[model samples]
Target: MEYLPNIIFAVALIVGIGFFARNVKKLSRNIKLGKDVDVSDNKSQRWKNMAKIALGQTKMVVRPIAGIMHVIVYVGFIIINIEVLEIILDGLLGTHRLFSPLGPVYNFLIGSFEILALLVIVAVVVFWIRRNIIRIQRFIKPEMKGWPKTDGNMILYIEFVLMLLFLTMNATDFQLQRIGAEHYVQAGSFPVSQFIVPLFDGLSESSLIFVERTAWWLHILGILAFLNYLYYSKHLHILLAFPNTYYGKIKPQGQFNNLESVTKEVKLMMDPDADPYAAPVEDDAAEPEKFGASDVMDLNWVQLLNAYTCTECGRCTSECPANQTGKKLSPRKIMMDTRDRLEEVGKIMDANKGEFVPDGKQLLGDYISHEELWACTTCNACVEACPVSIDPLSIIVEMRRYLVMEQSAAPTELNNMMSNIENNGAPWPYNQMDRLNWVNE
Candidate 1:
């Protein structure tokens, strides 16, 4: 009967971690549904990018207020969770303060954790106020309505509760240790939670133990729950940011990827001695059977990774010139739409036993619109603004490629320019000989 708590803890841990693993597997499968591309070049640069952007969060501080608050919450939450290791050990072995043997080191670690926990609570409160009360324009955008808004607020609440539970557990433990309660050892300092100790001053030893155990169990369970919740939330970036930044676009932003087949055709057209009807050589690097991306499957795996890694922070949209000028092209919405469609496709595949059934729906014209796609000036501001290296512009360009190449749906102005370029070798409706006439005029 004494081991029942340990058994229960073991069961809960297994279930929580097992569920999280399953979700991760599903996320991996969904991301892999997209086409593959070679991101093998620049290993050194990629590592540096991951380290600088994801680990160091260099881009996040572009706006000081939110970035500083985020760093506080981020650092504090991660550091405080180190105590979870101790909790897990204690739960499994039926020991209290399992690391108490470390003496002063343990006390110092606990003191630091207490301080961080308090900081995390304060940061979370500030985040809540910014989102709910202050109503930051980026946070209040159309894409952030409904579940997105609620999810954002809910995450803050979870962090708030978790920190409170940590302090409560620590305070009760401190009180119990002062009274020399059975199984409570003299260990660890609680700089922040020390103030919380007075609340338990009058409680009996048994009651104090009950409160501490309850808080401890709830805090650990909450962490587990938060872990699993990440799959459903935009917070998947918390895990995927490292890899996303590593595989992020390294080429110059203005340089678009040209179609291999189109490039070959253009080269042949310029060759004087090349046979017009010669059979093409079979090579490994071939253009896709279809031009451009009309759906999630048409995108490269990295772009899909970008979609999943979106923080929904709206920095991209806030920076986009098109969005700034009141166009329908919100870069944040572009990523959100891609992710939503990808999720829809994943669910469809899941329902049909691992094969995607034709759902008569696609990312283009359905989730995202023609107006939004056309509004983009290909300026790449969204790319620059993404803190985690998500390039929403890539998705926009791919969809635009599909619209132009597959459907011949390029705007009339673009069509006319393409025609002029083909016939006159310029984006003007003038003969080559007459092109220089503009100088005289």
Candidate 2:
């Protein structure tokens, strides 16, 4: 009973600290990125989004095998907490098995957890083999240079160890019961554990006790450490996935941010003593401000936050036709570049740097090349493929609007296409009058 209370206190303290640290780090990162998320203002909408993406696993289901594996893993993660609860209760009450009173119900839960644990282990092992042995090019590309592969390998190893520990602990517990050291078997039909019990029959009672205790601590502590590690690594998905899914945009995926109206106030600021709604003077003497993203600070906080939330799953890159056809455009690189730019600008902004906009060069000109931007077909393939629902197309279109409308520096082919749209109501070169000629023929 004394040991029970101590164990409960220790586990609670570790869990509390781990949760606090994870949230603090997430909050600090959001602040640094200048994220001003206010989903609270639209509670119903937010809840709907959460229901669709989080509970539904809408984005993950795009790949069936991966999706099924993820579903099992997700459900397992939630249900496995029951084991944690039982551990705490057993430690607190000085009981060999906390659920002894529940009889069949307890057995059912234990059996379910045992099965889920085994399934999760199998699923994760397959995922690891697919990523490493199958050598999915997207997963191991050179661009992931900054990412730590060891982190992924470590997480896989930890999960594997936890699963093994779970099976071993239950098997030993069942063996102890058969030998009459303990009368409680919370789960009666765990086939794996039962099959393994006969082999351990020769072991002494002291050895059995030591093995059970060791497995219990390993399983519990491994889970706790894994929880903490999730927050710091790419596995942050384990925590952030729910919130990220909830806050995802429900608007048309192809829709770009609208430009602010060029009203009287904007005109007055751009040119004094002129009709505010009128276009600004095109005189050579007038200093023309460059359009599009001039630097990282000019980007909206949501776009900046998108960088941190990216799962680096490489789905975007894999689906990019431009990348497939050997163009310089890598959607993955675009995301990484955005993250880097945000970090650099964040540092400068923190130091009270002069301005958000840069002079002489545009974002497309320097950070992401114009060729790369133009190569995008606006097909929404990248958007559709992203596991996190990142809308790269919107960003591309916004920058394109600035290039075409403000700088008038679009490609000659695109310029011709726009002219055709104005002259013929379509991007075809045929004159409107010529439509009658084709009909007559």
- Candidate 2, pairs of clashing residues: 4-91
Best by TM-score: 1
lDDT of 2 by residue, 174-226 (tens): 87776777544534557566676776789987788778888887787677677
Backbone clash count for every predicted candidate, in the order shown: 0, 1
Per residue, candidate 1 scores C-alpha lDDT tens digits across 72-161 of 887886787678999999999999989999999999999999998898888889999989999989999988999999999999999899
| Alpha-carbon TM-score of each model against the true structure | 0.95, 0.75
Worst 10 residues of 1 by lDDT: 279-288
**Model 1 ranges with Cα > 4 A deviation:** 264-288, 437-441
Candidate 2, 146: how far from true, in Å? 6.4
Whole-model lDDT, model 1? 0.92
**What are the candidates' C-alpha RMSDs?**
2.2, 5.8
Flag clash pairs in model 1: none
